[model samples]
Target chain A: MGTRNKLIYLLAALGGLLVIRNLYVILLQFPDEAAQGAIYRIMFFHVPCWFICFTAFLAAGVASILYLWKRRMVFDNVAVSAVEIGVVFTATGLVTGSIWARVIWGIWWTWDPRLTWAFITLLVYLGYLMLRRAIDDPTERAKNSAVLCIFAFVSVVITYKAIDWWRTQHPGAVLSFRTGGGNIEPAWEMMLLWNFLALGLIAAAVLLIRLNQEQVRREVDGLRRRVHEL
Target chain B: MRFLRQAGTIAVKDLKAELRTKEAINASLSFALVILLLFSFAFDPTAEQTREISGGLLWLVFAFAGALILNRSFSREQANDCLDILVASPVSGAALFIGKAVANAILILAVEVVCLPVFGVFYNITWTKRPWWLLLVLVLATWGLTVIGTMFSALTVNLRLRELMLPVLVYPMMIPSLMAAMQLTTLLIAGEPVTGEDIVWLRLLIGFDIIFTALGIGLVETVLVN
Candidate 1:
């Protein structure tokens, strides 16, 4: 197998191990909370999913800027790949948040600022993918979607601020790293970090796989164009 | 100064072309009126509750109908290769973008001017107290909408599904501006003075306008380059 394939397998294996170990620590080792018990555990996944989502989106936005600045196909590939992963992580974040809400807030959804902005962010990036589909030329697709991707990050920033500004049903920060840790158990904070590391590894592996797929797809498209010219 | 002149000249050129046909204005005005009528039927427009939602209904009409006008901004230049000629001429892409955005803003505002009175009549609301504040909100919000709409118009002008693509992309970005505009309009229409707390929405409107206007001008050259 190639070096790329070896790297993928290695990352996936390491990620799998960390994920199972994190799950063990999360479910078995961790005790039930004083309030909200098991449902609150969803935060382990929920917070990290957003962490992954924002990280991926930040990567995509930076790559898009580089694409525009340098006129590079690799940057375009990175932007598209990162976006696809970002969208999946965003969906995961929303779902995990929703499940937590259903238990705690007594509804499947609410139009609170954080939830509303999350939904809007999802729609905007989905629009980015649709816009990509509507264009045929590769260079035009890269440039237009690059511009759109950069603008789309604005929604992400707004979503982050939504919780901060409104402080609605979504609880304000409790994690021990932000806003002076907000009086949460340090053990829980450690567990959240472990979960984040496990998840980040998995997301990084998926990103690599997607980038490789995008590279292969581009090669095939280039070859097809050559054949057409012949 | 030269840039502003170029932009103004392009804006004038577009306005002249649009004024000649009046197709977009006619369509958007009628569409706005129809939405107002339909909304009145959907909700008892005379109800006390209507005052709470009147701003939302009004801006919804502006946004949707104004989209009709925005869609035509660049596509009209496609006839007889006018877009090519415009790009090939001395006009810069940024000027072409601002020019088209300004013209679209003016056209959309005109439609709003016609719709506001009809909306007032239909919804049984009066704007006697703060018409100037309402107008400021209208101008700021309309500029925000047209800047994003016009930029996306250029982006999607040549696509196979231009009409469908433009709105999907534009509306999400329009949310901040629309929310600010809608809330300010509602407050003003209710005869309430603009308070310190409400000033934030106005700030949001201005910030959104500045951010998007700058982005539109900065990126239009990339979007419009063949």
Candidate 2:
């Protein structure tokens, strides 16, 4: 009945439909790889998860800057929402990747640059959350974490360049926007597209849910304060 | 010009205060010595082994000592509400930040200058043979560390538990500079001739220092305003 609830359901329905379509193409339509075989199938989910992870963190960084500049709580909520979701997607990417590596690279883990960068990024953001929990003052927590997001994101950029700066066996990027999604076969491309659409819808829904939750929690805090005074 | 003069005056003020008390230098040097002693006790690695890891051990000293030193950089201002006095002055936040950063870097550099040869004598590392290259790397890398440490020091000045938060907040940001410095020092310690590889690490160090110094100047005002 409410507008926010309707929006959530609408996004969820759209995501579900797109995901079904993605599975249709993945399991049935797309042809298998001549070299990697069934293991290559995981790339569909792996790439999209990482794509979302990067997008989410970058969004968090921008929101962090805006929060510092504008002194707005909205951006703080946006930042915390984006970073928490980003960490989940990054974990998804890491797990999916490790599985793919187990089947393909003959080991569950490697000190490859991309994997190391992902782990470092995860720790850095995890540190962000830790700092948030450690500080009790709401304003201080928001401001410090905003400055921290900027600092963490810059370090991640340095980590990204580690491949070129040193030697590592981690494969190069998967979705190369420079080459317009490099070398994916037509059917595979279609599956990837639908999967990205599905993940995008899911990200939007999660962000909405988080923002709504924060709003309600703030209201609850305000009501508690009023009750205490009475 | 007036702004820079103010910045210089602040740095001089810190230097004078540090000279009179001699508190920070004593603590930082003692901390560095403890780290050196700890490394030997923990492993007591052979000359060959020490050569391999001396770069890492040296940075551990820098990271920990830098943390100790950075807290003092702002702690002086916290007494008698002197920080409010400075912030309320017409001098820009950038000046306050750079002055503190410079003073912290100089103090830590003095600690490192003494600790470097002490480490050499203790670890039996002959990398001191290339004192020029070693000092270059040390100076650049320590500046990079202090810039971030100094800014974060101001940021955490008002926190209830800053000592706990400072290292957690500062170490990750030090990775690039630390990595590059480690590589360069490793090369020098390995007795490898200076070549294109060392040049790459040097460039990385300079680039990191420049970027962070600019960032500190840009972002420190926000931290100081509160």
Candidate 3:
């Protein structure tokens, strides 16, 4: 296999192992039996998805800034790809969150601060995609979409802090070493960290694969247009 | 200063053309009146309901009118290729934004002024108390609204779906401003004392204004360069 393909496979295997490890831990040794029980199992998947989404969006913002500064179409492509992946992960997070909420809070949706902010983040990116479709010129589209990505990033900051700014019932800092006080059990903590790393790596791998595919599609379309014109 | 002069020239040009045609103002005013009438008919229009919703209705009229005005504000420039002239000139983007914002603010405020009194008459609401507070909310919120609206309008002016895209893009960003404005307006109309909660919204309004204004100024060049 090519080097990249081999690396992707390795990462995929590692991710699978991490997921299995998390499942094993949850099945064996969760602290709470009554409050968490089977529902606590969802936390491993849901929390990591949200973390990946947040990381992806922050990367998109950085890519947008780089694109605007360097005037590179590659940076724009990367930004757009990152945003698309972020949206997917965000959707996964939202769905998983809703399921967890349904089990825990007895409601499918709550105006909990975190949930509202998450929904707003989704809308902001949705708006970004709409803005892209609305503009036609390739250069204008790149520039405008870059600016919009940056603006949406600003909004995300506001949304993220809205919980802290206005008090709501969403739990704060799920796994903070500084604030959560007592150390988590070493086994659970190790499993959690490994799951996070694995999912983060997988998210990066998916983004890279999608970016390559988009680039190739663009090149092939360009070649076809040229052939037709000739 | 020179940029401001050029901006003023552009603003005056727009105002004069608008005054001469009177098309946009008439269309917007008539539209606002129709909306007010529709709301009055649709709602119970009893004293209680009217008092509760009048501020909201007035702001709603302003928002719709502002959208219409934004959609049309660039028409004169587009029709006569004035944007190219402005771009070629030495006018700063901030100045251009401010000038356009000024014109939009005036047009929307005019519509609001005309509509508010008519609304008061229709709803039997008193405006004599807390006029300053009401004006303060209107000015701050509308400034924020028009600044963002004008920037987006300029950004989308060259798009194929300019008409549809403007509001779609503008409304989402305007949410915080709209919420704050509506809350403040509701408070004023109800004659509630301005408390810490109201100040929070006021601060939000100010924050939105500063951030968006800076964003518009910084990004306008990028928008117009292409």
> Candidate 3 residues B15-113, lDDT tens each?
777889888889999999888888877867765867777667777788888888878866557867888888777887778777888888888888887
TM-score of each: 0.98, 0.92, 0.90
What TM-score does structure 1 among the candidates reach? 0.98
Q: Best by DockQ, which number? A: 1
What DockQ would you assign to candidate 2? 0.51
Which parts of model 1 are misplaced by more than 4 Å?
Answer: none
All candidates in order of DockQ, best leading: 1, 3, 2
Q: lDDT tens digits, residues A46-123, model 3?
A: 777877887888988998889878998888888888999889988998998889888888888987656877887888
Check candidate 1 and list the clashing pairs.
none
- Candidate 3 falls in which docking quality class? medium
Candidates 1 and 3, the one with greater TM-score: 1
Q: Please list the residue runs of candidate 3 whose C-alpha ends up more than 4 Å from where it truly belongs after superposition.
A: A31-37, A111-114, A177-194, B41-43, B47-57
What global local distance difference test value does model 1 have? 0.89
RMSD of each: 1.2, 2.4, 2.8
Can you write out model 2's per-residue Cα lDDT over B1-226, one digit (the tens) per residue?
9878989999999988998998888988998998888888788556577888778888889888878888888878988999999999998999989888888899989998888889888887776667788788889999999998898788778777778877777787777788788878877777775686568778889998998998889888887777
lDDT of 2: 0.83
Q: Each candidate's DockQ score against the native complex?
A: 0.85, 0.51, 0.62
